[model samples]
Target chain A: MLTVLVDGVASGMLLFVLACGLSVTLGLMNFVNLAHGAFGMAGGYLCVVLLNQHGVPFIPAVAAAALFAAALGFVLERTLYRQLYGRDHLDQVLFSIGLVFVMSAVVDWLMGARQQLITLPAWLQGRWDFGFMTVGVYRAFLIAVCGAIVLALHLGLVRTRFGARLRAAVDDAVVARGLGIPVTRIFGVTFALGSGLAGLGGALGVEVLGLDPTFPLKFMVYFLIVVAVGGANTIVGPFLAALLLGVVDVAGKYYVPQVGAFVIYTAMVVLLLVKPHGLLARGAAR
Target chain B: MSAALRFALQALFWGGWAGAYFALPEYLPLLAQIAIIALFVLSLDLLVGYAGFVTLGHAAFFGLGAYAAGILAQQGWGEPISGLLFGAAVAALVGLLTAPLVLRGGDLTGLMVTLGIAMMLFEAANRMAWLTGGADGLQGVEMWEIFGVWRFDLFGRTAFVYSLTVLFLLYLLARLIVSSPFGLALRGIKGNRRRMEALGTPVRARLVAVYTLSAAYAGIAGALLAQTTQFVSLDVLDFHRSADALLMLVLGGMGSLYGAMLGAIVFMVAHHALSELTPQFWQFWIGIALIALAIAGRGGMLGLAGRLLARWGGR
Candidate 1:
């Protein structure tokens, strides 16, 4: 039971990393960015390339992957997403779907469509034997790192000038503009931060999920399910949803092998039926 | 005399173009395939264009039709007409059953529901190996000769002519439906559902009808595919198939039947050419095309054509 709890928390942390970015972007921009998973895939592939091919160390490889993904996000926002900022939801969806195909194809072309294995370095490879339970060092490290990032993000959002400006802009862009805040730059910066977090998640998740060309397309639905079931704009909502989903998924797979893969979607449907505005009514409030 | 002569000349040119493709033995099968794809895209256009319903599960109907036809053939129902009828009937039944649940929600709700339904069908197809032949799919579907005259040979000579005729007939039917009062009601629903409902348009029932009609079209297309290919695979119900159909409809421009055809032609041509050139990177090229079109060409190929014609007329 303790092992399951630990495993569930680790999985939940990974989900939170993906869901938080989706929630932030969806909350502020009201743009359903389906292409977010592509960044994750790209980051994972980049980390694998850096570590396996270029002989880079682990930490630097992850950092480099995050930076690269952020840069791509920056370019994408400037070139394609800028035009779609205030467009209809259908156009945004189609454009992002197109981007998914393009990004996945590029990665598949370069990486040859095979799943790449990512192994942790020696320092992170061992297991810690607790008196009650033995835990993977890597998994424990991932949980710790993700938790720290979440704490840092919470602090940054609640207790910083940038966070204040972001809140103001998200509340009303026109009002922020009236107050002489650089709303456009803030939007770009926020998008980059969200995308960077997704990259980090992808890089770390490689050890757990492996790297494949179709990974983004397959895993994206689950992330969106989380974002949709949780309140899109609320930070704590995703955290709650992620933990709930992670536990359900792990427990379902262990307990009911046949229907395990479908538990998340079923849960999402039930949640939506009961509360169409999500658990916290983000869509309704918006 | 001069006006009559010009009309005759133009008629001759277009008639020759259409006739050459239809009559040629080798080109018949290709033409037929194009027609089937055009019908598939047209079905999508009705939802995306006329009804403003963005669905990613349209392939469920198509795949169901294919499996229906395949199962019937396996059970010794090899007659072509009955096979097509059976496929359409099964698809329409499924679509009608699912329409109420699908149409009650908002845009995002509808999308997720359809997606979930499609995934369920896909998983069921994989799991029920006895019924759907599992992942291997149902093969060896032998089609009977049309009216006891033309055998569907391996060369596809008969299949091509039959599919072309079916496509032309369906095109006319779709055009008529889109121009009818019911079609106007759909347009009204698309523009403003609340107002239409207040005006007593029975918006939900109308949407369900249109959804069923579109499913029937998809079913026919799928039956034709199974008949022509002599096999049915689980890939028919895949998400990518639905995505491709959506892409074709959008690329062609919504609410335009000819646009769907034009979009399919352009997309298929590009896919064939790009895949031949760089098979691994073809999706990237297609994606680039889609993004470029979305950014630059709002109305798609038809829109571009209209603009060019206007420019030339002005000159």
Candidate 2:
């Protein structure tokens, strides 16, 4: 029981990392980029190829994968995403979905339909056995890494100038532009950072979630759940939501193999009915 | 559309399809698939183009219709037309039951709810091996002769004509409904929800009505696919199915019934040709097409055709 809960916490942290970008983008910019998962898949593939084919170490490969995704994201932002900033939500959704299909197919051609796996370092590969309960060493490492990231992200967003600029740009682009905030550049950098974060999450999550060309379509619901059920644009909301969801989903699949993913989806529908904005969103009085 | 334009459109459509049937009998199966797809896209147009709802789980209704008809046919109630009607009713009932949840939220919430409903149903169909046939899908779905006369021959001629005729008739009904006052209200709501609400329009009720109507059409389309193909797979409820339908609608043009037809024909033909060459990589080309469509032409192929039609007609 303790192991299951601990495993859930680890999975939830990975989900938060993958989903935070989407929530912030959805809430702040009102842009529904469905292809967000495509970048994560790219990062996953990149990391796996690096580790498996090129014989690179794990941590360095993850860092490089994040950078590669961020660069790709920057280019896409300049050429494609900029054009879509003012389009309808429907157009954005459709356009991003198209990107997803294209990316999926591209990945399929590049890598066969087989799933990609990576080897963990010696220290992160074994289990840490306690007298009463045992947990995987990798799981403990993930919790520590993700916890530090969450703390850093929270502090950075609250204290840093770049974070303040990002928040301002998100809250009201026009007013922020009037205040000489370089809004467009801020948006570009922020979007790239978000993409990079998704990439990092993907690199880290390949073991837990499995890496495949269909990664985006398969795990899209989880990312969206974290964003929607947790409040969009808020840091802590998705964090807590991801933890709760990760626990519920893992436990549900374990206990009720018959129902599979149905229960989580039902919970989402009911939750949305009671609180349309999100579980943590302020009253929709505005 | 003007009466002259409308008449010309119908003549061109029927004439083109009928002529194509006689010319390329071998392509009947593909053309029939295209026609069913057109009906599906038309249903989406009623919601997205006219009613201002951008959904990601429109396949929920399509799958319901397919499963309903598939189950009916397997149980020996195999009359094709009645099966289609029953399937449509099932889809409409599902849509009616879920309409309130859809109506309660804005676009993001709407997207999530529809997606959630679809995923839940998908998982339900996947797990219930007793009813939905599990992952292998429902088998033994046989259909009776259409109106007790035209049997579905191996040549697929009856299937082609049946689907095209069904599509034509449904198009007429859709044209009538969209031109009606209720459709006018839907358009008004799409343009300005706040203003419509201020004008005392029953916004939510109208939305529910249109959504239900659209689901019925989608169910009929799904039923047509199952009846013509004699199979019902879980792929009917797939995310790709919904996404592909959305792509087809956009490729055609929104707010025009004929756009759905034109878009469906073009997209399906291209997809068929491309997938034949490189099944796995066709998405690369489609993605490029979508990107081009977004960057160069948001109105889509049909929208451009409409512009040409107006210019030529004026001349």
Candidate 3:
């Protein structure tokens, strides 16, 4: 039971890392970016190519993957995402879905449709026994890395000057702009940062989540669930939501093998019906 | 805009399909598929174009209908028309139950809830492999001849007529509904929910009614596909089908019944041609088309045609 909990927590942490970026974008910008997973996919592929084919070191490759996704995010935001900001939700959904399709097909073209495997370093392999409970080293590493990211993200959002501006902009874009905040620049940077975090999560999650051309589409719901259930416009909401989802999903899979993901999807719909704004609805916007 | 022109277009549309019977006999199967897809898209149009609910999980109803009809046929009820009704009835019942859940929130919430429900159904179908046939799809689904007269031949001649006839009947029903006072109320609600409510319209009731009706339409379309093809697969419930249906509706033009059919025909033909050459790469083109559609603005092919026609008429 403890082992399942640990595994669930670790996976949940990875989910938090993966879905936090989406929360910010959805909460702050109110942009329904279904294509967010494409960046994560790109990060996964980058790590695969760097570590296996190029023989880059593990830590550097992961860092490079995050940077690469950030840069890609920055470029796409300026060129493509900026135009759709004022549009309605339907347009945003369609455009982002289109982006997802294009990216998935491109990845499929470049990398064969087969799933790519990453070779974790020797230290990151195996498991460590802690008294009555045992945990995999890679999963522990994931927990540590993702935990640090969550802490850093929390502090950065609450304490930093940029975070203040971002919060203000999220609160009211027009008022923030009037207050001389570079709302557009903040959005671009925040978009890149959120995307960068997704990339980091992607690189780290490759072992657990699997990497493929369909990465974006397959995991799109997970990210959306995290953001939707966590409630937008807040960090703690998504973190807790992701953890709960991770636990529920992991436990559901382990116990009720027959039901599979039906449990999670059903829970999401019920939860949405009960709390349409999300579990943590403080300052939540449409 | 005139009645004569409208009647002529209608005649031409049916005349074209009737013409295809003799003209392109070998391509009847493809035409039948186009008709089925058009019906599906038309259902989506009722929800999206008319009711203003942007959903990504319309395939929930479509797949439900397919499985209901397919399973019924497999379990010794090989009758076609009843199979279609059973499919639609099952889908409509589910839709009625879920309408309240869907109507709870705004667009994003609706999208998520719909998607979640569809994913749940997909998982259920996948896990219940004993009944659904799992990944390999439900095989040995033997469909009976329509009305005990026209047997389904290899050439698909009977299938085309049956599907086309269903499409025409449904098209007329959809037309009547959209032109009715209830449809006008739906359009009003879509335009301004608050105002509609203030104007003494039962907004929720109307929405539920239309949503249920649309689900039934989708079920009929799915039943048609199952009966005509004599097989049902998990792909019927796939996310791609929902996305493709949305794309087809948008490509044809939203809120326009004729546009729905036109878009289906064009999209299916292009998909057939493109996928024939490179199966995977065709999706890239479809993506590009969606992006283009988003950037260019709404109304799709019919929208563009309307603009051009207006320009010519103004001169």
Candidate 2 on B1-315: residue-level lDDT in tens?
589877997898889999989998999999899999999999999998899898899999999999999999998899999999999999999999999998887878889899889898888889887998989989998999998999998888999999999999999999899999999999999999999999999999999999999999999999999999998889999888888888888898888888877888988998888776876677777777777776675677777877898898799
Provide TM-scores for the models. 0.91, 0.97, 0.98
Clashing pairs in 3: none
Which lDDT value does model 3 have at A257?
82
Model 3 chain B: which ten-residue window has the lowest total lDDT?
B271-280
Give the CA lDDT, 0 to 100, for residue A71 in model 2: 85
DockQ value of candidate 2:
0.73
TM-score of chain A of each: 0.95, 0.96, 0.98
Q: Mark the regions of model 1 whose C-alpha exceeds 4 Å error after superposition.
A: A1-5, A129-134, A255-260, A282-286, B1-24, B27-29, B147-149
Off by over 4 Å in 3: A283-286
Positional deviation of residue B239's Cα in model 3 after best superposition, in angstroms: 0.6
DockQ metric for all predictions? 0.53, 0.73, 0.79
Across B1-315, the per-residue lDDT of candidate 1 in tens digits comes to: 257864786467336537856576665666667777877888888877888788878898889888899888877878988898899999899999889777764667667667767776777777677888878988778888888778898667777778767877888898899899999998998899899999999988899999999888899889988888888899988888887877787788777887887787677766755666776577787677667766774677777767776788688
